[model samples]
Target: MKTKLLIIHSSDELYGSDRILLQVVQALRDTYRITVWLPVDHQDGKHQLYRMLQERAVEVQHMDMPILRRALLTPKGLVRMARLAPQVARKLRSSGADQVYLMTSACLLLAPLARLAGRKKTTLHIQEPWGPREAMLLRQLAKFTQQRIAISQTVARSTGFAADQLSVVHNAVPRLDPANPPKPLELDADCARGPRYLVASRWVRHKGHGTLLKAWSMAGCPGTLYVLGSAPDSANRIDVRGMVAEFVSDTASVKIIGQVANPQDWFDSVDALVLPTDTVEGCGLVALEAFRHGKAAIVSDSGGPAEVVDNGVDGWIFTAGDVPELARIFDRCTASSLAAMGEAGLRKYEEKYTPERFDENMRAEMPGALLGS
Candidate 1:
């Protein structure tokens, strides 16, 4: 009989951390029975996470966990978690879970759950930057968790985990075949704009969409910008749309392409990937996605994206939030340079970031008996 594993994931959206968790679950579902507990389910219909996990037949559970939401920082939030911890611990003990895994930082609150169940062999995957406050919050579990998986060197150093306990597992995903890849969506090539650049991420304040817009305008409106990913559903969503519209006031130089099922399919149409992040991101999977698609990236020198991009080798890196530097990069990149850089990036992905590499990583981190028949 295979060992049963219980995973605590932070969000419902299929972002970088979520994608990595899906990859691990997909790989080990055959060797170990897997159950995933998500904080919430996608609104309206389904998010990409639900559909993808269903295809693999992995069991997903949705529960209202206060620690997973914004309320965790409030006074009432601490009271709620203090009251809820024991109940969650009971659920873990009753699940007959052979192993417990924490998939993201938000799931760190569940550290008490594994301990209360007397499961000492818990693994915590740190996907976010661990500063002093974050380290202090998770300090209690530093000695308890059996394994610590860091997505980058920056994260590994920040956590100060013992060398024996730490495993640096970079985020990875399945690559689309380059020969007969997803077809590009044909659009009007009216002499109305220059070459196109794409931004594929959740549209939030921290993503630096506004900075990209400022740089695009400052760069003399070099090319058409295609913004992909889910538009924010916040009260600011309309304001965000208005801001984007204001950026491209007269000409059709910018587009709020909204969300898409497979942004990679749309990638076949754009010039290069642009990620202008203001936060100290853990690992920008967007850079990997771009590389796998034989595309180069213009990433901010913030955190993990820099690790993915070899400065001026496969792509360019500008100081994060420096609109003028971003504008300068946009000014320099042409069709020929983008292709050469993309080919180099593609080589790096094939050499480092494939599914085989992901499987090897899991096998290395997990015990032999659990991952093997």
Candidate 2:
């Protein structure tokens, strides 16, 4: 019988992480039986990956758990996880999976179940650095797991995992289909008085939308700022909306078109992309998305954005949370300069982020390490 590998993830949301996981699964379907476990039915759960898996006849198991929003630290979540651990462990062992792959460090409780299954039958794919308590749990879990794959070098260092124990397998997604037709909404040359700027990110305080708006308004408010992503429905959303409404008084200069099915629809309308996040980021899918669209980016110099931007090569980087520095970049964004950077961005994306490259990487680094051993 072929070896079975179980993928344990907390959620099946339509986010970058989930998308990447789906790509990896699709690539590996010929070799192993891929079973995905999720804690809840995500909003808009009918994602591209979900549909693709169904077509491939892959198994997706959803376990009903009390996963409240922003309740990871609450006692209720901890208790529920404790109760679910044994049941999940028994099922994982009964399925006869050769290895249990835990996708997120947030699955501290689930790690123990994988560990109890056997020392050689577990592995972990960690994306972000964990807190002290979580880190301690990760260390304990790592001892039992056969291998640890870190998404980035920075994240690996921050997690305090043993240098030898962790291997960097940067996240990969399917390359944008160039043969696919561009969105119908074409850009009007007259619409852009200055260089067009695009940003696709969730509306949250730490995402630094306020700073981006402030910088734009301060830089004489030239160019159109196409802000994508839905304004969050949480309390923070109200504050973000108020701030954006106050700063973006001119509808022509700035527009907040909430979430689109495919952001590429508007990507062609922009000259460049920008991400001004203050807090630590995992990896900015928007930056990669911009690259896929052949658009240059100016991202904050922290978190995953910092790692992606080549600082004046394909794109530029600014100080995190520094509105003045962001404004300075805005001042330098001329149409000619942006066009040159866009060309560079496309070159870089083709060179490094292609689906072919990702398949080669996994075949070389992940097969025996993750699924075989």
Candidate 3:
């Protein structure tokens, strides 16, 4: 009989961390009786991640659980957390799961609760790189878990976990069909004008939307820059459209393609992907998606993307948050050059970042007891 596993995740959006959660379920579904528990539904009513899990035949549940967020760090929030702990403990006790998996760092608060609920074997997957203060607190909370999984080495270092307790598993996405790819969307800009670039991330301040806009304007808008994604319902949201209006004069040169269901469809339209993140990313999964689609990436020297892109080979890496350097790199790139780099990226993706490779790594790195061995 398969060992029952209960996975608890904070968000329901189909973004980087959310997609990685789906990938984790796919990798372990056959070996474990897995059920996912989400704190809430997507605010936009799309339920993209929820739908995807259902389509995969994975059991999913929605409940009001304690999720760690910026708002939940205040005095009143502490009281609320204190109140919710018993309810969460009850849910965990009744789950009938042999093991509990916390999908992201936001769910780290549940680690101790899971232990109190009599689930001794708990795994915490760290997908976000936390700041020093938060990391200190998380390090304390992490002691309750038996195993830790980090998406990248950068994230592992941030967790302050001992080497023996943690494993680094770089994230990967399923490769798309090159021959029968989704139809590229028709934008307002002319396709034959110059090279086409894309920036697809949540409209958050640290993702560097403002810096990308500033650099695009500084580079005289060399290419058609298509911006995808919208701000989440959070305090950290950025006014992406306002920034574009402030920096970009020739509006037609920058197209705003709002939230997308399948970013790979847009990946089929652009020559390269640009990720100008102001902060460290756990893993730049979008860059992997670009590589899977046989496209190059122009990323900042942030934590994860820098490790993924070879400086002058598969993609270009500029100094993080350096507008002038990014602008210079943008001005120098040509359609032909990006295409060559993209071909190299495809080769790297085939060699390292495939679903099969990720599954193998998961099996090798995860504890044998968790795998029911």
Candidate 4:
């Protein structure tokens, strides 16, 4: 019989963690029976991921213990773990899972329970670099896990996780079809007079929309900027709208369109991808998507973008929060050389980013970690 896996994901939001779980589950379905465990109630991308996994014939398991979730963060997390331990212990003992994989930092609390459940090996996929308190939690729990999977080397280093103890794995996405993606939005010669750029990310502080606005104003960028993200409230959306408001133009030159369900539709509309994140990003999944679609990326040097973008080859890199350098790089990408660089980005994605490649990696790492008994 094939080995079974209990994949614990605290939340199933459409963000990076959920997406990575979906990709890994798809990759490993052939060799292992996969059970996805989510602690939260269903949301947008959660439904989508559930559908996707069911379509692929993977089993889906949803658990509801709101108290455990609330307690999992405080002293209550340990208390809740103590209260709920028996239930998880029952599942682990009864299910006969050979390995348990914890998908995010929040779910790491379950490591000890997993170990007790007869899960011979537990692998913790650390997707973020925590501060002192959270790092302490990980430190205390580290011995319960057999392997530490880091989505990027930067994240690994930031965690103070020793090199030999962790494995750096680049997050992979399905490669885009170069030949027949939907056509880009047409721009008239006058509309095309200015450069066109795109950025797809949540409208949050660390994403560097503030820096982007500052650099755009400094550069006197005449191009239309298409910003894509969902706005939870007026205040959160204001920074983005305010940035475009400052651009003083009648040409729809800085259009802040609302949230997009299918980002590829917008991806088809622009010339390049821009990521100016000032904080740590576990992995720049958006940048990878941009590259997969054959668009060159101009990204900040702070985090995972630096790892994905190769100086001037596949994409351009700039120091975080440096307005002048961003302007220079933006101007450079508008040049004739930009198109060829985009093609290079496409080649890089095909060679390095694909579900099959991720599947190969998981198959290599997971099976051996399973209990021999």
Best candidate, lDDT-wise?
A: 3
TM-score of each: 0.90, 0.90, 0.93, 0.89
- Predicted candidate 2 versus true structure: per-residue lDDT over 1-373, tens digit per residue: 6668787775667677677677667666677778877776444556555565677688977765333234555787667666766777677667677767777765545656666765356767777656566667567756666677777776787678678777876665566567985674655753557888888878877788888888888887778888788765566663555666687655467776777877777887688898888876777767777787788888997677778778887788998889888888889888888888888888877787767776666656556645335
How accurate locally, in lDDT, is each candidate? 0.78, 0.72, 0.86, 0.74
Clashing pairs in 3: none
Q: Rank the candidates by TM-score, best first.
A: 3, 2, 1, 4
User: After superposition on all CA atoms, what RMSD does each candidate show versus the true structure?
Assistant: 3.3, 2.7, 2.5, 3.2
Give candidate 2 regions above 4 Å deviation. Answer: 41-49, 65-70, 131-134, 235-239, 248-251, 369-373
Candidate 1 global lDDT: 0.78
The regions of model 1 sitting more than 4 angstroms off are: 40-48, 64-68, 162-164, 177-180, 188-192, 235-238, 245-251, 368-373
RMSD of 4: 3.2
Error of 1 at 369 (Å): 12
Model 3 TM-score is 0.93
How well is each residue in 285-314 modelled by candidate 3, as lDDT tens digits? 888988988899999888888889998888
Root-mean-square deviation of Cα positions for candidate 2 versus the true structure, in angstroms: 2.7
The top-ranked prediction according to TM-score is 3
Which is better, 2 or 3, measured by TM-score? Answer: 3
Local accuracy of candidate 1 as per-residue lDDT tens digits, 95-131: 8888888887677777767877876567778888877
